[model samples]
Target: MSSKSTQTQFDKNMEFGNDTTELIRYITKGDGAGLAYQWLSTLVDGFGHRMVGSDSLEEAIDFLVKSLEEDDFDDVHTEEVPNLPNWVREDDNVEIIEPRHQRLNVLALGGCEPANITGEVVVIRDLDNSKFVNVSGKIVVTAQQFKGYPQTVKYRQSVKLFESLGAIGVLIKSVTSFSINSPHTGSGAEGARIPAASLTVEQADMIDRMFQNGEKIVIRMNMKSHSENHTTTSRNLIFQITGAFRPVNWLSHLSFSGDQQHVNLFKMKRLDEIVHLLNRNGILLGLVNNPSQGDVRFWAKDGIPSVNYIPDKAIDYYFYFHHTGGDYITIFKDGDLEYTASIFAVLGHIIANMDNWGPA
Candidate 1:
């Protein structure tokens, strides 16, 4: 063996000089496997669906921050989080008063203004192409289905659709297949608007029959709706790590740091969604779609709630590192459409050397 090889072996055997060993020791010991599992399982599965502003979400954030501090990370803190306003359903009722009076199924639209007075209901084909010019100050009924329910509902959205036409309120046929004489209430647009409600298919059909018979259909609507706005708390989480060093090539690497870069291939939880959406729109973002041709890497387990750090040195620094202009990355859950149908996100942390950077 050469003199350098023999000397390196002797140093390792005697534990004389090994800076790399110390760096690995710090990370592996600091974030042991068993401890990692415990921390993640307790947060994700145990807490289950921690919605923003909920007490459960706040508790989870507290747990995360405390755990980090326990691991000896310093200067850990949070940034302010913003969220949309909440709208809730209130009491609502609808009924046919003529051509055999009967109780009708009904639901109030979200954000509908409270009604201090009950009003007569008038059914019509369209609010814009209305045959009734002075139909204002009455509950207008229309037959149209609003798209994107639950996420972007429009069950009670007519308050704004016909308010300027002198409409005081609105009643729409429920946007569903089977009518159990049940009305479905959902979110409505903001501001001073008229109250809106829904009616069952049976009741709507009955109205259509009345219109066919040339009999004026009379109905009534009563609603009590309002809202309250207040400040609430939220959370933003982060996972961090240290970088590796090459003592032998330190001078050369530093001199080329600005131009040379690294290419990182991240496996997202929802990669399929990303691929499908991007392909559907005929858009490309420098990503390889096929798994066989893609970079092979290890991903953290579902039970492991924390982020994994994979060291990648294959990328040429001049062309790859920080090429996207942003530091965030995303992981898409392939089949899970219920929670984040399109993507899940992550951020990167690269350090010059472990000893140089620390908690701040």
Candidate 2:
């Protein structure tokens, strides 16, 4: 068959005939490809970091709602969710006053109370019970190895434990395995109020070495971090696409009669088909095998099976850029957003047209 005839036959097989062909071609080849990138740019560049309770976050939510409305999506709205305490770091300084006078680069951990202290630095190589003593009224320094974030986060979030022991302040080495003098910052102790900061691995190692050599290591830390306890309203943006077929009460009754395992298997099959369709359309390259957690867990608890897809290359850069000052629009490559948006559009179209998508 001629190329034109082959193309014509392929178009006829599409479920929506010319409409499907036009939509797919427009998404893959037209300006629809850049939609994701454009939206991301507006969110990151225009509104800045969307930290909870921050003005930027509220603005971002508004932007998403408006964007969805402009796209003519049905039922575009925001749902209020619990807010986190607003924490901001104003200024911080760390200096080694003993053994040798030198300054160190640091970033105050989020939600850490502000404090200024000059005390003898004690290095704890591990979180063993034996290391808990003699930490009173002294600066506690702990080394962090490159365990996954979930596994190693306890070291940073232990401010309450350290505070109860009368420790004046806490300094944790960056948890990341790779860094160029970057000090990562994350949530501080949940309930305890104490000053906490992260130091570059090199700085932490030097301090540890000095302490191990029996050198009198005194350090002065000045941090101006602050947190507001008041709760603020936040929102989750949701956009829905109405399916073509109407739901029937009998279908839900029949669905519950099947073996539970079979129901799960069918859901997995549908998910696999969706993934395959995106892959065949050249939207997805490969799967990311890393175990990372995100908002998908919340959706799962609500009985919704959601997939979190990050670009293949994004998995490598996630630690370095995510939740850091390095998270900016510049990190995204050209066509990255466009491709992602196209994939989502195609998936939404397929699901919306399904003959039987059980239960509301």
- TM-scores for the candidates: 0.43, 0.79
**Tens-digit lDDT track for model 2 on 52-84?**
788888988888888878988777878888765
lDDT of 1 by residue, 223-248 (tens): 76555465355766654443334221
Backbone clashes per model, in order? Answer: 12, 1
User: Candidate 2: worst 10 consecutive residues by lDDT?
Assistant: 248-257
TM-score for predicted model 1 compared with the true structure: 0.43
Instruction: Evaluate all candidate structures by whole-model CA lDDT and list the values in order.
Output: 0.45, 0.67
Stretches off by above 4 angstroms in model 2 are 1-28, 82-84, 128-133, 244-262, 285-293, 355-360
Evaluated with lDDT, which candidate comes out highest?
2
